[model samples]
Target: LAKTTQPISMDSYEGQEVNITCSHNNIATNDYITWYQQFPSQGPRFIIQGYKTKVTNEVASLFIPADRKSSTLSLPRVSLSDTAVYYCLVGDLNRDDKIIFGKGTRLHILP
Candidate 1:
């Protein structure tokens, strides 16, 4: 399995762009990087995903380099309501392997 590393916590203010980077040293070619965001008392929701290069959605953008060793999840103009925990998942969806989740990065959006 590919391991992910992220900061334990982050602090940002309203209307700020926050980028959380996740490192996966042993990521495989078929593994896709996926980002999820979870609120204090809610389930995690998919933010963005990418195999290579960059992928963007209304909520966020995912950037993966050619090496695929690391990925960055960018949240544009985040607000106080964006406070939550973000997780990075690296896995092959076509496989039946178990999913392992690393300790998520806690994000605090200030007023």
Candidate 2:
């Protein structure tokens, strides 16, 4: 599995957008970059994923560099309820993986 590093925290005002980036310089060929969002008590939920190029869903957009060494997750027009922890993981999604969550990027939204 490829190792990933992410920022510890970020602050944003309500109605503004947020973008969080992760680094994985040693990413493997079979690895895929995945992003998950977590609230205070809920388990992390998949936000978006990609092997290359850009992928967007109703919630967020994931942009991956050509070399796959880094990825950025963009949250559009965030509100106070959007405050949460964001995590990045690099590995095969179909495999029995035990991903260790980092302290993660704590997104704080102010009204």
Candidate 3:
């Protein structure tokens, strides 16, 4: 598993775009960059995943560079309800690996 680093907290106003970046210095070739968003008293919800280049869904977009050492989760026109903790994980999702959850980046959407 590749260790990830992310900001402790971020703040943005409603209707503004929010980007959270994570760094995985020891990412492996088979590793995939996955992002999750979690609200209070709820499990982490899958946001996006990408191996390289860029991936976009209706919810958010994920960007991964060629080196795969870093990734960014971009949320367009965020709202107050989108406030949550965002987690960045790097690993092979095929096998049953013991996944560890760290203190993720807490995103605060202000009015």
Model 3, span 9-76: residue lDDT tens: 99999999998999999988888888999999999999898999999999999988888889999999
- Record all residue pairs in model 2 with backbone atoms less than 3 Å apart, i.e. clashing: none
RMSD values, in order shown: 0.8, 1.4, 1.0
User: Arrange candidates by lDDT, highest first: which order?
Assistant: 1, 3, 2
TM-score winner = 1
Preferred candidate (TM-score higher): 1 or 3: 1
Compare the candidates by lDDT and give the number of the best one: 1
Q: For candidate 1, what is the TM-score?
A: 0.97
Arranged by TM-score with the best first, the candidates are 1, 3, 2
TM-score of 3: 0.95
Q: Clashing residue pairs, candidate 1?
A: none
lDDT of 2 at 69: 96
Steric collisions counted per model: 0, 0, 0
lDDT of model number 2: 0.88
